[model samples]
Target: MPDDPLPTHAGPFALGTFRAGRAPFPGLVTGARVRDLSDLVPSVRALVEDWDSRLPRLTALAARTDGTWHDLPDLDVLAPIEPGQILQSGANYRKHVVDLVAAEKESLHGATPEDARADAERMMDERIRSGVPYVFLGSPRAMCGPYDDIVLPALGEQHDWELELALVIGKAGRNIAEADAYDHVAAYTVCNDLTTRDRLYRPDLKAIGTDWFTAKNADTFLPTGPFLVPAAFVGDPGDLRITLRHNGIVRQDESTKDMIFDIPRLIAYVSTTTTLRPGDLLLTGSPAGNGAHWGVFLKPGDLIEAEITGLGQQRNTVRSSQA
Candidate 1:
C-alpha cells in the first residue's frame, strides 16, 4: 500500500481537464504531477456547478488526490470546460481599436496616418464617456487545447491570432451589478481567439460589417487552457500582461490595463443583457499589437505561443488544411 497522503492547508490550487483514453477528465495540477479526479468527478462541469462550495473540497483533495499519478506533459491537457455560451468582447482595448480606426480612416478618407491616429484617439475618449462595449458570441466547438495543433482552414489565407484574458463564471445570476461583478468569477485562463482576416467583412453587405461566424468559428480556432488559476490568486484581471509570438517573433505585447472596459463593467454589461451561468467564459478582449497591426498573417507550419500573466501558457502550431 502507498504511504498515507498529507493533509493540505489553505490552498490557491489550479485545476484543469485531461484526456483519459478517449474521454476527458478533471485533475488537480500541483508540482510536476497531475492528480487524476476520474472517480470523484464526472467532468469539469461538476466542479463549476457550485464552485464556491466545491472549491474547498477540491483544495482538500489536492493534498491527497490519489487516483493515479501522471506526468503533466505525458497527459493530454484539454480546454478546462465545454461551456455552451462563450461571450467574447471586441474593441475593448483603447490602443488596439484606435490603431484599427486610424488605419481605416487613412485608407478610406485619405487622411495622413498621424492625423487619423489623433482623431481615432479622440474618438476612443468620446466612446469611453458615452459608448458601450462590443460583445460577440463564439462557438464552444471552436475551442481547442492550449498545446494542441491549430489547423488553419483552407477557406481563408489571412488567419490571425488574438490573445486574451478569459474569465470563468462560477456563480449564476442575472443583472449583476458592476460593484458585485468580481464575486461571480471562479478562475482565470488564457485564450487565443483566432480570426480569418479576409472574411471579417462582406462586400455584398457593406452596411452589415463583420461576419463573426465566418471569421471566428473555424475548428480549433480558439486555443485555451493549459491551466485555470483560481480567481483569488489572480490579484487584478486588468493588470495582467498579454503576449503572443509567431514563429519566435514577438507580435502582440501589451497589458490588460489598456482595456476601455474593465472586467467589472464587462461582466455587468453582459449580465444585464443575458443571464451568466457557471462554466460560461467571458473574454475581456485582446490588447494592442495583432497580425493586422504588423501587416503579417499566419501561415502553415507557424508556431504560436500565447501567454498571460499567471494564467499559464498556450503553445500551438498552425497547420494548413488546403492541401
Candidate 2:
C-alpha cells in the first residue's frame, strides 16, 4: 500500500465515492481513513446536489475522529461524482495557446518562428482583452476512476494527456454573471482530459475545425478525482498548480495563473448556452506542456500521474483497445 493513497487537500476533509464489496457510496476522506457517508447521501453526486445544506454537516462530521472508518487501501476508489453535464474550456491558457499557435505558424509558410511567437503573444493579449472563452460539451460517459486504465482507441496513435482543474457546480443557474459564478461551484477535483491528437481534425474537411467527438470522447478518456475538495477550502481557483508525469517523468507543469480567462468567465460563458446545475462540471482548460510539446505520446504500459493543488492525484495506466 502507498504511504498516502489520497493526495493531501487544503481542507481537513474531502468527499469521494468508494466501494468495499457490493455498492459504491459517498465517503468522507480525512488522512488515511475514510468514513462512509452512505447514511447521509447515496452518492457523491447526491452530496454535491445538496451542497449548501450538507456542507456544514460534512464539516462537523470531519471534525470527529471516532467514526467508523475504512482503510484507504481496502476500498475501490471511483470517480468522486458522476456529473450531469461537462463543459470544457479550450485554449484558455495563454502560454499553451501561444505555443500551439507558434508551432502551427512555423509549420505553415509564414514569418520566422520568433516572429510567429511574437505575433501569437500579441494575439493572446488581444484575445484576453476582448474575446470570450472557447467552450465545448463533453460526455459524462468519458469519465473514469482516477486510478483506472486508459484504453487507447484504435482510431489514433497520438493519444495525449492534458491534466486540468475541474470545478463542480452546486447550484442551478442560467446566464450567470461573472461576479457570481463562484457561487455555483461546490468543489474542485483533478481531471486528465486525454486526447487522440491524430484524429483531432478531419483531413477530408478542412473547413470544419475540430472533431472533438472522435478526439476526446473515447471511453475512459477523462480520469477524474481521488477526492472533491470544497471551494471554500480551495481558496482561489486561479492560482493552483497543475502537474502531470508520464512514465515517472514530468511532462506538464504550470500554474492556473496562466489562464487567460479565469473560472468566473468560463462558468458565465457556458451558462449562457446551458443551465449550470448541481453536479455539473466545468474543466478550466489546461496549461502549457503536453505530448504535442514534447513530441511524445502515450502507449501501452505507460503510466500517467496527474495532480492539481488541493484537488488530489490521479494514477492511470495506458492500454490498447482489445478491439
The numbered model that scores best in TM-score is 2
Mark the regions of model 2 whose C-alpha exceeds 4 Å error after superposition: 1-5, 65-67
Residue lDDT tens for model 1, 1-323: 01212111113567889875787788887755778887888877778877999888887877875578776756778987778489999988999999899999999999999999999999999998888889999999999998888998878778888999999999998999999999999988889999999999999999999899999999999988877788988887878888899999989899899999999999999998899999999999998878888889988889898788877777887887763
Best by lDDT: 2
RMSD of each: 4.6, 1.6
The models' CA-based lDDT, in order, is 0.85, 0.90
Evaluated at residue 77, the lDDT of candidate 2 is 83
- Give candidate 1's error at residue 246 in angstroms: 0.5
Per-residue lDDT tens digits for candidate 2, residues 221-265, read 999998899999998889899999999999889999999999988
Counting only residues 3 or more apart in sequence or on different chains, how many pairs clash (N, Cα, C under 3 Å) in candidate 1?
0
- TM-score of model 1 relative to the true fold? 0.93
Clash totals, every prediction = 0, 0
